[model samples]
Target: MKKILSLFLGVSLLCSSCNDVLDVEDISNYNPELVWNDANLANAYMANLYPMFGNWNTGADAFSQQLAGINFYADRITITNGEFKLWNYGRIRLINQAIVDVNKGRLPDAVKANITAQALFMRAYTYFEMVRYHGGVPYITVPQDRYEDDLAVPRNSTAECFDLIIKDVDQAIAGLPKKIATTSADFGKIDANFALAFKAKVLLWKASPQFNPSRPFNNAYWAQAYEANKKAYDDLKAQGYGLVDDYSNVALVERGKESVFTVINSYPNKVANWDNGVRPGSESRGPASAVPTWEFIKEYPMKDGKMFNDPSGKYYKSEEALLQSFWKDRDPRFAKSIVWNGKVYEVSGKAGKRQYTALGVAHELDDFGVNPKAGVNSTNLDRYTGFFILKNSLLKLAQAEVQQYDVDFVVMRFAEVMLNYAEAANETGKMAEALDILKQIRKRAGIEPGADGNYGITANTTAAMRETILAERNVELAFEGHRFWDLRRLRMLDRLDGTTKHGVEAIAVQANGQDMPIGEAREKANRYELVESDFRYSLLQVPRSGVKVNVVPGKYYFFPIQRDILDRNKNLEQNKDWGGSFDPTLP
Candidate 1:
């Protein structure tokens, strides 16, 4: 299948003489009938839709850091009136055109069903993106053959847009196969499982606080979301979907059973640079981009299922103690997801040895030996936080380089489905079901159950369980590009306001005369110690000093539609609080 798709990519869209013939009074343009007639061509066209999946590593992940309180604000991120607009109609046009062609094509019912299902899925997916960003956009299903009334369709209501998304997904689910066989030619194709999972996610968003905010919380919406999530969870589980036993290798292992939907990339064709960009400065080929902030790092729970910062717990009194115990015996996911100070990582081409040095610390030659200076000035190219993301960093090789390996980027996995179910279930008063799911996830993470066989979650009340589920999601899905959207949908961005991002500061202390050529008898002496460890936590200044950053719920929840789009379409309305007049030019 890959080889066939590659062949299509290499071919020209039209013959060399076709353009010349058209210039000689042949004004009629060519239709994409060949693409619809051939299954391979249709499949190739569908492949183009895969790239539409978000590249979180490069784009939104960085922007999301502020909202998630995961990183110190390096620069103030301005919220503009044109943050994201429904300006790009190219994908929509192609999807609509494909749907039209697929319905009219002379293919077998089975073949046509799969192709049409995929086209509808893409269309729904695109519209979902638009609605999430800008509340209501014009729901145009049919391809615009000519300009006239079709070109100036008015904007639909937010509920109308969501209804259309659900409708399209339902059609896709009915037509798509339950499962794609491993031996089939189209192994990684979208199936009913993907559609169902997506439908649940959309419904969950619709029920979230940002979208369905009423004076009194709407329990009915939550119930609806709960039912949808439950159906998706049960159906996906029956189809053999479950979490990977080892969370560390989730990204390393491609298209495993845990993955329900993922963007598969292969070497030479498409490759992810996450490993190169997220590895620590000392180990990475280039400057690391996604540094894990102290705010995020401190969120991981202890091995005993207690918050690391709990006042009644065994909290680290000093900075030295914090760094010493921070990575030691904490949540298993912590070590699997982050590389902190003193965490030794394997390097290729030599016998790997455990080593520790604060990021950007300089090594200096001394009488005792080469000593690492903890207070040495470092560049931003070095990690701003003392930690780096370890989940996507494939550093087990002899020498890990940028863009060398093709790691599949997960979009939706079984673990996320479980988390969604747990949240919705709890909201709808299904406490026992939610707790069971939470216990399963916690057990997989190596968290021990309490005396009562619970995962130390004594909170059976809805409010407490809600808090528990949110925290679990935070740790379980950290750095997977879910934090920002999660915060936004919950209308909880204010939680990050007035918070300071932090990192660890430490100096390496070496034993006296350690660098000297010691006799065999003296070789057993202590070598070094990390001393005077301190937490470097500080409030970030935005738009100059003394201005605390805050996300206004009314204005900032939904992004504004671009000015040019409003100009082009007379019926379109700009989002409120954006300070724009909707003076549309009538045709």
Candidate 2:
């Protein structure tokens, strides 16, 4: 492969002819001097830069999907192919070059600031993605050049990796324009709100069960975790970011109010559009690239702010009753996050008229194949039966499908910051205060708080508090792709691994000549149909075919440079696990 280093490696290499209009001929080849001199070239480059974070083939979108439990397999397991290896190195190359270019001083101050902040945010995000999957990675800051001597660095300690992440994000926050106050071309630059929200994410993950100092139960880490989350909550609030007053609109109409930051998508620039990425029904998110698990659906609590398993409640009657109770008067997010049999989604119907129907855009055969089976999980191969996702998804009621939804795939949202604050407060012994914050989020969602003020949580102890926080995290961020990571980080992957039955009684009733509610029947049909045994192995390990396995517990925390990466640099050392590791207690 040709080694291309355009932006950050050197400023003098950019061609001077590039201008602000999106009209550069021979755009494939990079001549930074020209591109950097023209504000439009700089803007175009920046525009392309942010969406890079949203692509499923790259960035956090890919990582978050894996972490969130929406795996390609039935449960949490991940399958491997050569494309996986290529994906890792390719991302590193693309991001490094973008960062280098933005740092060069040829663009306007505002343009330069926005691009630099975005690049930093992306870089930090990329690092987090790596650590969560492969553990500590070699901290590569500069682009690789023939003359560079530092190509073979070993894995940085997770803590060291986090420190570097903090620095990049801090710089991003300092340089990025304030999102709430900014407008026009600079409308969505990375800012204090985004930076702080991201920091909370990193810190919260680190403070989680899997990454905290303790392997499974690290109570001590709670204080530090809480502090990290609290910082984000306090800072974003000071900056005017908050929950959308109406709960339902938060996921549908007023996404910006709660999102700390996102890759903003628009029409015509459909290349930058997530339209194809998350489309539901027969054509979109339902077709199988990403599928929702029955267990994941079961994780949602009942309307009275209690788990369906609560022994004292009516929700515990049976799987069918439990599922029905879970969605009953609980929260508005249920409608926004889930697609049931009869739920109406906006789509273009056959008559050229827009219509709302439980089935979206009627199922039809296309390139992929048939629609998803009623109980069968969708994959890249299968299409949606009729249901589709509406949250953060753009749809139309016409054949000329134009995407008008502006809700950015908020990489970070203020609502998340608030949850972080509540979780942290609970850990730090500010239980009442934590409960208050939790209540505010619930109130915004039109649900009353739990008796403990944290979603009907009765446990005041730290352990119970943590569990409540995790549950709350799932509901607030469901379908946005937070559950998988939150579970893994909390070391609750095993709990989420097994199959769960939902709406059993409803299924019986449907069979016994009774017309059951759509939600109940859908739950029964979809829930009992799943066989979940693979979630435990979902977090992928680097393939043994590509490199020797050296990842031991402490040493095995990151991906080793591919042997190809090593062939080029004799100075680099591999991560501990790739070459030799025989710890008997692998989780």
Q: lDDT values of the candidates?
A: 0.64, 0.51
- Output the lDDT of residue 179, model 2: 58
lDDT of candidate 2 vs native? 0.51
Kindly give the number of clashing pairs for every candidate: 2, 47
User: Per-residue alpha-carbon lDDT of model 2 for 4-70, expressed as tens digits?
Assistant: 1122223223434322121223233465666566765565555544544562221132233222222
Question: What TM-score, over all chains together, does every model reach?
Answer: 0.84, 0.70
Clashes of 2: 47
Error of 2 at 414 (Å): 1.4
Candidate 1's displacement at residue 47, Å, is 1.1
- Tens-digit lDDT string for candidate 1 (470-545): 8888888887767767877777766654454445443332445232222221222122223222212222222222
